[model samples]
Target: METTALSQDEVLSLIVSQLAAYGFSQLAQTVAEVTGAMVELAPSSRLSELLYLGKEQDESEELEPTEFPTEEDQDEPMEGSTDSYSKYLDFDIETKPIPRPFPDYTQLYYTQHKGPCRCAAFSADGKYAATGSHDTSLKVLDVAKMKNRSGDAGDKPVIRTLYDHVATVNDLSFHPNGLVLASCSDDQSIKLFDLSKPGVKRAFRYLQDTHIVRSICFHPSGDFILAGTDDNSVRIYDVKTFQCYTTPPTTADLHRGGITQVRYSSTGALFATSSADGSVKVWDGVSGKCVRSIENAHAGAPVSSVRVSRNGKYVLSAGRDSFIKLWDVGSGRELVRYEGAMHSRESLQAAFTHNEDFVLMGDENSYTVLCWDTRTGALVKKIQGMLLFIIQLRW
Candidate 1:
């Protein structure tokens, strides 16, 4: 931590610097309240971070080959708030010593998919990219070969496309070993792709009657896969036996709503789910027992997405009500609320940056992604020009 004397201007500068460089709005606000010095998002801290940053890739190592470049330079900085709507920002400008030795940013784009991609994932080794799309198809790409992931041509060749589903594939996850890809669809099927093979093909497919497989996740140990269906129950499937447990995670007598999303903790010790009722449940990852449940979590608004933090300490949920709330994993109580970007009536996605400094989310109506300071709920940036109605973003 960079410490400074309370009387110096560096106090204010330090507070604002970390807030922009990181997402420590709590520190910025605390210092601002103590000193009465207005703080704001620093202009110089973000341009390089946003336009240049990516998972560092070696020339030899590959995350499944793609046409995308590892880095790029931006002619201008990303657009931030200037209108009256941006009331949380510090309106007045102040000078502070610029931080030296900014990190270089490289950008990559992958655009071979035929339609709007509803879901996507990178292989555990970062070697391949898989997408579930509106065309009711799934495409797997070689990220290493493309060099750059972005492509304007929708017809760009992919390893293969799987087309067995009749409806949109809502979510997809990779086995821990990256040997297989699992997907769940609104068409009422849970399918697994054998990535260990050179070509794309289904290794297993489980058909369901009335329930749509809305979401699915793999255990960190690669033992089993968890599926959440529209029928309001969670099912576990054994990878070896290819059989789904006859029992649901909760009692069959419980009247739960359709599960909108599911995520496992970093250790795979616990997993959590969000339902159509905006409620949430935490279950033991191994035993598949519902240990904690939050009812009416967002006051009846359907949860669009749910994620456990990279540190496994916090759980975040994005809702149809147009807000993202952070929760204490232990207490199950809401801690912070992030808002101000458009997500109303859409299943916009939310997740933490790799380092967990900021909370990132996308808006369907705005066609942009917004960054919020995680420690305190402050809109840091509104980013555009990279994606369209981004429903999928992963590190």
Candidate 2:
């Protein structure tokens, strides 16, 4: 008797369905090393349709790639409040020294974690900072008092360190109310901490997921929580009822790959999701319907993160293609492109400066933070000094 060899899709399916103790780890590692398999999706499955495999690839061709603006040419300031928006419009990128708005920005205020800090978030009031690490610990620190971990502050600035997760923490989000902090981990659980109360070693509330929770965000109203999980689903849970309200009506509406990041617009009128399927979709916050889709958003490379602009007029997305592009929310057109960061491997987060004057992200290869002038796409600054990968960034 002869046996047929397993196909790529068969192997991927096997990796996805198998339990941890049955040698699945070894098989999965081998497959990832050889094929660079970011996420497993069956070829004939409804989800795979988003990949545009085979004949469907022709349809994607009709959506041409964005034409990036010339580096020296600055377009009209994005529609935002009349502060700093137009200040840099006429500043010559080639001649002007990079703006030194904060002279002390380069001075490091280090907070050491026993393990690499994977996710971090600032409370709505910006008085507190929370970081979750691979050590399965979450630390809340007072931002104003944070000093070099090796210096006099030496753990004194740490408000609380909670150990509740059995696995690495993947993401953290703060409720708009500023008194609650939420954290998600690879242990397949999300924990909520009451920041107003102290001396609590464990989360006050817990929520469970079928797969690893990769990213999370809170609704502007603080009434619900949004989570992106490895199950290829974006879920919304009510804060009061703890009931999951995410119900997609069709398979076509679902992401074909694991969601890397999910974020809501400033006004909570819409939300955006980036997937390993190389797509960024904007969905109506009320109806949960995909209002705009940017297919092949990164030329078939997995989009690692997506952020809605502070003004709610643009979207910023980072892809494994090593490019960060800005898109107009109303027109669904790519507006600007920023490069020079080596980020083809890790699922890194990108952010916009508070005033939306600059774009910021981490360089996985160099382990440094890269900031670019948003209007000109010119390298504004590169801050270094990371012992390992910079998984997440927030300014």
Candidate 3:
């Protein structure tokens, strides 16, 4: 028969008590909406009480949620999603599942060589993988049988031995045509080997005066080779003419600090360089002008590797700070900063998957190679091995 009006404090207390019973997560959603509405109605009143209540509730409910999809569920399509092409909305596409317990890498295979391997490359056809180790030997593994879409462990790859380098081989690149293999080393030279040739004796070596070649890459057209060295410059070599053109970066008065890695853009018109000076530099492959420089890009650590997305729109850099930075290549602005243990150490090398949907990074710890979803920054797959380096096979 009687109605009593509750004071503002009483109303707030009752709301908070109910939210506490429902749990902090649900309370958070409710409070967010209520706060938004409250701001619109009365901007002066501070939601301090509600904010404190939410904080206390969150502290009490500290355990993380367990409603995660199983590995099997990850492979299946959503139930209500239509099979028609038009039903494929932007958010409807299934995301790669996150790894459980993270990925533990162990040595899958290792061979005793003369020195430490500085680089590795997979054949363009995906039939073989070559490693240039510190042992001064080039080892090729027959990955033909190991080429499974699921990446599950199977038969071990057959190993072929090629001993040539007197010093650590720092870089290895396979030509796009699949017939020639190129390698650079601390010995200050780049060697081209013809797989069609019979043995180690049949391989032809190209000697360069540049010492400590840190990185080497083959152009998309396979007509030229790009090599980055400790000399603080990048050299472009014409494979046929055996002539080399050097790009000396004088804009910043230095080539960052010993160009650690170099890559040719997918379009072949541009290239990216990652240096120990904590910078990522983009240069015109033809004119050699430093178009964009992201200085202090990865502060407190060296920029170990840089990769351009297959679409040439995104540039991803991994650094010693254990951070992977995603940048808009066109505007030269950072888009995302992913900081986690998976990327939390020196990511010595990185490669983009065939679809450019994921990036695989090789870390110094355990020689672990991890795959990250380019869009979501989620861990996709991990390959275990003591890697000298990891590279995606490009066909």
Query: Which candidate do you rate higher for lDDT, 2 or 3?
Result: 2
Better of 1 and 2 by lDDT: 2
Question: Which ranges in model 3 have alpha carbons more than 4 Å from their true place?
Answer: 1-116, 145-159, 248-250, 342-347, 363-367, 379-395
- lDDT (tens digit, per residue) of candidate 1 on 1-395: 77543556645655455453333446656766778776564412332222222222232244454575433221111244222111111212312211112223234544555767899887778777789997888888777656654455653536767767778889999888877888888888777777666654654555454688878888766767777787677777777777776334446323278888888775565678888877877765544567677777777888878888644557888888888898876787887899886777667778876445467888777787788866567787877675577786665
Off by over 4 Å in 2: 1-104, 147-155
The number of clashing residue pairs in each candidate reads: 33, 0, 11
Per-residue alpha-carbon lDDT of candidate 2 for residues 1-395, written as tens digits (9 for 90 to 100): 67666667655554542311121345546665576656542211222222323333464355444587431124233344332343322222324333433212555366778888898888888888899998999998887776345456455778899988999998899998878999999999989988787788789999998999988999877877889988777898888889997737668778888898999875566789999999898876666778788889999999999998754567899999999998877778887899999888788878976556788888988888888877667887888777776778775
| Candidate number of the best TM-score | 2
RMSD of each: 14.2, 19.0, 19.0
Please report, in order, the local distance difference test score of every candidate based on alpha carbons. Answer: 0.67, 0.75, 0.64
State the weakest 10-residue window (summed lDDT) of model 1.
Answer: 83-92
Candidate 1 stretches greater than 4 Å from native: 1-107, 146-157, 200-209, 246-255
